[model samples]
Target: MGSVIEREHSATGSMALGQWAVIGMCMLFNMINGLDTLATAFVLSSLSAEWALNGFQQGILLSASLIGMASGSTFAAPMADRHGRRPLLLASLLLSGTTMLLSFWAQGPWSLALLRALTGIGVGATLVGANVLTYEHASLRRRGLAISLQSVAFALGVSLGGLLAHALNETVGWRYVFLAGGSFTLAAGLTGALWLRESFEFLAVKSLPAQQADHRPALSNVATNSPVPSLASQRLFGRGYRQHFSTRQWRETISLATAFFLVMFCFYFVVSWTPTLLVQTGASETHGIKGGMLLNTGGMLGALLLGLGANRYGSRQLLLGFLLLNAVLMTLMVPATQVLSLAIGMGFTLGLLLNGAIAGLYILAPQIYGTGERASGVGLVLGLGRLGSILSPVVAGVLLDAHWSSQALFTFYASSLLLAALAIAWGRGGTEERAGRSRN
Candidate 1:
């Protein structure tokens, strides 16, 4: 009996060893996910010209995608909680990739917008599933590091998309970009279908004792602190649990949501209008695209460095520090333009910090909730954040239409970063310890 137990432990250890490999594979999926999310930004100008779109139309397109993304976030979290993580993720990847591939065939702006919105749904769902998978598999000490690595993967994808678009858009055409980007998602989906395993925790929940007489599983494997109420019994607002968004939880959620709004607002604005900004500053479309690529590269580097810092200082300090740096870099966007290298360098710095801060939010959010409520909490926060994403492009369009100077654009972005800094400060308290306890 003792030897049998020892053997089981050995097998568990071996299984864990394979998790690192799985994590690496998941990173590829993360990259593909980022590509799908940001590809629209790269092609916005081309689409505007080809379709003869106005600022309002652009805003509508951006908002449409964001609304779909929010729908995914709102639904997928509960699904992941009730179902399992791996299955939902696999489905998300396939659906998202297929939708993006279909976008290439759209005949008009409305069709393209619909397809893009569907793609956003896939992207949004996949983001939550992937983050949960990676974070849950990680040790408490390394949780922040794991999340940071995912951010790096995302930044790398977006950066590469920018660079690739700059180099190939003239030769291959914009539709090809969509096709190529979509292909990555297809590859990731196939890989996941072939290699991904159900999470052990999720499996343990499902494998709970069966009813011998009925020959069926007795209870659902989904985690929850409260009793499993019927669909009609479940209530989000009523006194369902001991703590329904206590003061601390509400503050944490609000702070994170606000930070997400500001960061996303700036991020989408840059993604949608970088090319236009470059042109306004007297650069070619190619130069503008390259600058976008440079910014992403900077972001990737920042995520890598911040991942290391997360292991040392915890995600909280790292987030605050990064937010401050991002504010400074964003404010300097106009002045740094005189020297192209300075502009690129500054953009890179901003990207790094931006990616890290956002990643910090993902890492810390799960720590704040119990196992049962985790998915719902994460879902709600991300859903609200999508509202920010929805607003960002619209705001950018309005500013562009107002004939705002390039300097004014940078200045506006700077204010968002400053607000993020404040939110980060407000959210401080017990996050690292909470994360550690969740792992135990």
Candidate 2:
């Protein structure tokens, strides 16, 4: 079985038709899932007016699907490990598509939130299926490049979704936006149910449960945390802070998790609020939609840029550079808001830096862990990042409710990114020092 697995992984260059099909399907899933996850954001302005939502309520609405994503990540992603990737993927797609379709009739913020949460479950679960299947399908040499496209597809989805929402919202109404996303997602699910192939690696692992008990069959295994990056210091600032990171693995884990948390915190804040805020500045939904689209458009480019740079410069170094750049961009975001073009340009730049930072983390995470703990370590980092994602909008909302200005809010988040950059640098230095000691 191991020999067969090695042979399959050894195939290089062009993939089989079946392999391309599976990988393409997963990318499609990721793309639609992106649209489904951010569906509410597209119509937030209308929803606010219809429901007379306060900043806090609006925050909850923006955050509802994220909360669902966390739930799905916890409960559903793991199911693929047990039930099989194919089944999980199909089920999650159907679940997400159905909920998104149902969202067209959501009566209030709470109802919309409920539907969005369900959609997020599917979104969350599909991530596991997409990532696992992508890794399993691609040739070994091209695996990293292929899997990175998932991030590109996600950004594409959001960008296209902005265009879709504008057209639909202008022609008909906001409900149509949800309806469109749900229908397309459902159509994809149906197509996938018929055509999507199971992961050969998954089947191989299942053939020998004895060998799989302690480790994933595919450990280099595209550690996406389902499409991402965390928070803790010696258990996040405990007594043995120095001793805690004395070990190489622990140092990597803590530093990476902290970096993940801070980046996601800032990333979600920008993703969740930019459209609405942009709308406020110009008194126009077009401004918001354009800003949102440009942000994602930049992200698509950023993912590619990171992929190119990681190949030449190194993922860790490039990631730190992106993070530091993002911190500066975040602080300047408010000033950009005053001018429509400037605001949108800043959004694009921030998207480039922020998404690049995120893709960098995803690219680097699996490298830091051994097979036995890859899943756990990546999961921990991802979970913390999700927590940050969930909290960011709510925190922003509360601050805004208290009448905080955009400049202050952005500056505060920038500080988190700076701290995150520092953590990554510290981890790199500490891990190197520890290895130096061991070698001696």
Candidate 3:
């Protein structure tokens, strides 16, 4: 009896520690991902001057990383479902870090784009892998908060990157920024390899029924001895793509992807060009960096607030409200950009609402697919969604070259946000809350 009680206590301790470990480590990974991914944006001003780049060329440079991100999300992220999240995450981190370091040596636009693209792929894969890992570990009731924390960490990293560039670019030049970011990322990869563990759900799914039966006697002493209930009984990917999901599932997935695409399009446009746009409006390079930092700082706060309220108020309702607010903010940003103070304030607000709404979408994502296909499902959506990111910068470049005002561009994107909210409203509701309640 004493031994049984000890075993039960050990099991409980392991379970609690495992959850914390996954969340804490994944959050760290996401922070690094954000820092490395946004480093280029932070340094783009210096790079543009150095290369004597045209507007179209600048847009291409910004879009190159995003294009790589799209490919990584579609192809590399899904590998987590088969190989396990930890391994894929480590590999991506290493790849990203290596490429970022290599980018420091880039002599021209072509070489720089190539390196940035490779780094983006790594960052993209890491993003998807970390999300899936965190979601699987978090209880349903706290999933929103957990994912929000990840977003908060990411935003914090972006803010830090901007600040670092602002402080160091003049003193050290842009090359050192990549050097620092790459070194930190490689360190993060090592930390993950040492400390991270495979998702329990993935482990259970991989364990054979016969093997489980053989282990039952050993696990029976614990009060909660059963394996985590599998979200789907179907084989991973099944016989074919069509056989894996029903028509309803497909529709829901497509709707989520559409919403993701639209929001990301708007988000990346602001992120990629806000600094340059600020410069065009007569702000110093320092002020431009400050503007970017303010946007991310607001994003962190917005994500925290949304996470706290989402469970109580309902994810869908919060999402809609946030998106609506984002549209209003984006429209207002037109006139706000004319004044330095106003632009800073508006940029923060825009980041808060826009990023907060996106966080809500991340909370809703894992609910749409079963465990068997969750990684692939999320990856595919994010990958396809990156198309919007890839195009937004290039499109914005063309328009800017044609002498389009920032006011007109933001207003157009604001309309797109409304359309995205409508698309999300038309989709299926999340089952995660219900699942969490049932499990409790």
Candidate 4:
């Protein structure tokens, strides 16, 4: 029995070369996903000028990819559970890149919107797949840090894309930006195909218990000791899948999904509208671009800080504090906008806290489910959360069209943050109670 346990430990030992390779590839994938996701924002002013788009039309264009993202996260990303993370990730990269390239030839708003939506499908799937891969590859001790680093990579991509757009929009035109992003995505896809491996935990779960019987003694020992539930016994789908989860599991998923939805509502509104909002408030188009970059810059910093502190301070406590602070900062944004420097500074700080809240979610998400359900669990949360993204731009645009002040719009967004904080607080309480019961 002791020998069997030793073999099991060896077989399931710490992350190795393949795991590191997956982490590096996931980082690159997330960076490209970020670039593609935010590229529209960087080019929105230029695209509007060229296409002669109205506020409503522009809102549709901004929301188009987000709609696609929601669809992909809901429907396409879940396929990773059945087919394999690598295939879905590679396919998403290819599809998104091809569609984004096609966007450069768009003749009007309708064509561009269609292309953007298609690109978003790829971006959304890649986001989910890459995250699952990252989660599975890291050692249990470092998983939170790995996920947070991925967010940092994504944040850098957003900032870099904005800086690139600001530099090239006047000289090369917006079409070139699409061309560049598409080319990079295609290249990254090739790299991923060549280097990325499927998750080992995924493989272990898919293996039949009979086939893994030799390791059962060790596995049983692990089940008794580890916090992570054993996935070897769970079915991959259907009634068996439903039977796998208890009421507490379902409640945890629902709570996380709700918090994710509320936070994303606020996040997408800022990412999709901050530049345009700045322009509307009398800033130059260049200042608008700079504002977007500053926002993402703060996000990178926020993610870094969270990664460093999350293990020591506790993720839930940090998340709750970040959300409340973000609420305050966003409310203060109203007055800050009256001064250009102050507004830019506040945008950075708001982005930091906003992304800190998001990073907190990313840290907590993987802890809630085992390998068998991790992809689907994270995908569902993200897909549902994207409803906020899909709705915010269009709704905010209509309100702006009706002559709502920028201050009023921000105040409304701040309110969403408060609601999100409440959701997280509730989730924390439930999780703690569940942990206590499990311990007793």
Candidate 5:
């Protein structure tokens, strides 16, 4: 009687088609986000030439979307916890798609920056929806792998973007790249509106306000005796939120935020800057793009490995390992650049560890919050992390202008990961939170 039907132990790896579809679609959205993000990095060579831009100007262009992402994470994503995820996710896709399409007409740095910033907002909010939806929908056994695969989608997108950028940049020019990203995104959004399934848990929670008694059985259509009545009243930062905001949760949030920030600071710097930095190192533009692709390819494998290994070793323990490896990789980047093969190899390995760390963080964050606050908690952590993402590129631009070598930059960013490892070690949720997950 105390059990929720869906929570019953399943044969390992068993997943419903609906659950797979939701997670699969979320992966597609993440792919779109990745392509849209790296679109600017690929186009920078053309953009600088066209606009006569300086390092700072290019940094603005790169960072504009991230600023919007930060805002979306802080403000727009939290709304998913209150409203439904499907609509917000669909709306974000449409918004980003339209803005990206409109980017074809950008006249100057600020014009393109403005459009990109708007795109960032959509992408940022979509990030929250994708993670939360996947977390809520996936079964306990396959949950880690599903979430990790969702994270891999972004890396897949970046790998494809690198290839596409090289192909399209030379043929149709940079504007077409934005057009492609926009067209694909809008397609996903329109289709998602028609097909995306609302989370049963979200539905069950929503139904609680209208039916105070025995809500789960009616709303879920799955046998369940457990009823969490208090979820319906939990508004983020409102009075109901007070019910879950314990001192322990506060500490967990801070530590998660810190870990997210540091890891992401390094993540963006590597992905966004690797190609450009490689180009600066006398490699041709083609090799530069290859450098970027290699990173994401390694990332895909690394995340998959982490997911597969998660059930054996704990998620937090594997995550800390990834974080530590990342610091080591960053420190090695300078030496790797001395040889062409070594440079490419290092990019791939670093990407593996860095992207793996990110996937690990995404998998970890949602486990700390309940159905009611999951989106908000993850969004807050991701939003704070985007600050690091937003800051990294601009800082690189400034440091580059100041004549900082790639070695210095790589070494400097590596320390952020070392610190991030410490944060990960410290970010485990308190015993009360563990008890809650046990209850679930």
Candidate 6:
């Protein structure tokens, strides 16, 4: 009886620790992955003024990173399945940190763009690795919840970048902002190295079921739907996944990718170019930047609340509500800028609704595919989404180049969210399959 009780207690402890480790590590990685990237955007005005860059040039600089992200995201998932999650994630984090440090050495727009591209590559790799690992680590009962927490990390990192850039730009210089963010990534990576263990599922891929049957009896019950392939070729493009790479899958990928693309285009446009937009609207640099940073804070709030809420109520409804709310708040941003409180409130609400809803898309993408094709399915979705993000800056720059009114810009943003809502609403026809392996 004592032995049974002790075994039960050990099992409970392991379960709790696994949940915390997976969620907490992924969140921290999310924070590090985007911190320097976001800070660069906040400091772009200063860089432009220092270098005499036009709006189009600035947009090109922004596009450089997305270009790398698009490429990197395409390959990251396959490598994660091919090798394993932890090593690749660690490498991505290291690359992100190193690339951030290199940004300090950039002398002009072209150089900065090159460095930014490298940073984007690192972010793409990290994102793919992080999401796949989080899904592998989480209990089936709470997989959605674990995945959504990554959105919280994204908001936190963005907010931190904005605040840090705003606070330090006046005193330490914009380069210092990159350095600080980079240092944080290095530190976080080191901590992760010490604490993070390989996911049990990844280990299971290498072990025979019979060999795992004695002391590791728990491994015997791993769900077949979880795709425990020992080889990458067996999992991604395997016989079981031929349908996933077929015409039907391509159609689904395109539809969802386009909707996600629209959403991200709006999101990145607001995030990457908002400071420029606000400054163009006759707000002083200080007020414009302060307002821009507020959006990230709002994003963090929305992601945390809606992400957890979706776990209870369902991702579909949460996504619809958040997108509709985003449309409403974005429409208000044009007039609300006249009042400080109202403008900040609108920015916050917009961030929360927009990012939180997008987070659900990330969770849903993997679910839409069978276990055998999970990595490829997610990679394609995010790759297409990055293309949307890539185009956002150019589109916004064109509007600004043509002297579009702030109201007009905001209107475009609002309409995009509405379009995204319509797409999601009309395209909700798929069945979801459970992943095969549980993290524990």
Best model number under TM-score: 5
Against the reference, the lDDT scores of all candidates come to 0.69, 0.72, 0.78, 0.77, 0.79, 0.69
Tens digit per residue, CA lDDT, model 6, 84-132: 6788788878888888888887888898888888888778877877887
> Which pairs of residues have clashing backbones in candidate 4?
none
Error of 6 at 1 (Å): 23
Worst 10 residues of 5 by lDDT: 218-227
Candidate 1 CA-lDDT value: 0.69
> Residue by residue across 1-440, what tens digits does model 1's lDDT show?
13424323432233355556557766887888777876776787888898899976776665666787787876765576567778888888888899888978877778878888888888888777777777655555565677678888887777677667656567877787888878889889899898887555444434544332123211221221112322222224233333425664777777877887788877777655655666667777778867777667767777777777776777778888888877777777777777767766676677677877788777777655433354556777787788887888667667879998878887888789789879878874334544444666
TM-score (C-alpha, index-matched) for candidate 2: 0.78
lDDT of 4: 0.77
Model 2 Cα lDDT, one tens digit per residue, 1-440: 23554535444446667777887898898889878888887888888988899987887777778877776755666566556678888898899988888888888888888888888878877775676567667764555556667778888888788779878887898999999998999899898989997766556444544534334334223222221111121112223223223464677778888888889999888876788878877738977867777888888888878866764566678888998888888888887778888888889998888888887776655455432233334444565567888778778878999999888998999998999899888875322123334555
In candidate 1, position 11 carries an lDDT of 25
Tens digits of per-residue lDDT, candidate 3, 295-357, equal 878899989999999778877789999999889888887677789898889888888988998
Give the range of the ten consecutive residues with the poorest summed lDDT in model 4: 217-226
Off by over 4 Å in 5: 1-13, 209-229, 237-245, 272-286, 397-406, 429-440
lDDT of 5 by residue, 1-440 (tens): 12345433321237778779989999999998989877898899999998899988987898888889988887788778778788879989999999999998888999999999999999999999999888777766676788899888988887787678779989999999999999999998977987888877676666665445334432221312223335443445343334334663766777888999998889888987888877877788989978887888999998988888875676778888988877887888877777888889989998889878888888888766656676777888899998998778778878989999888998999999999988877766433234435666
Query: Which is better, 1 or 4, measured by lDDT?
Result: 4
Worst 10 residues of 2 by lDDT: 227-236
lDDT leader: 5
**In candidate 1, which residue pairs clash?**
299-351, 299-352
Model 1, position 396: C-alpha lDDT score: 67
Instruction: Spell out the clash pairs found in candidate 3.
Output: none
Q: Provide C-alpha RMSD values for all models, in order.
A: 5.8, 6.7, 4.9, 4.2, 4.1, 5.3
TM-score, structure 4 vs. true: 0.85
Question: 1 or 4, which is superior by TM-score?
Answer: 4
Q: Give the better candidate number (4 or 5) by lDDT.
A: 5
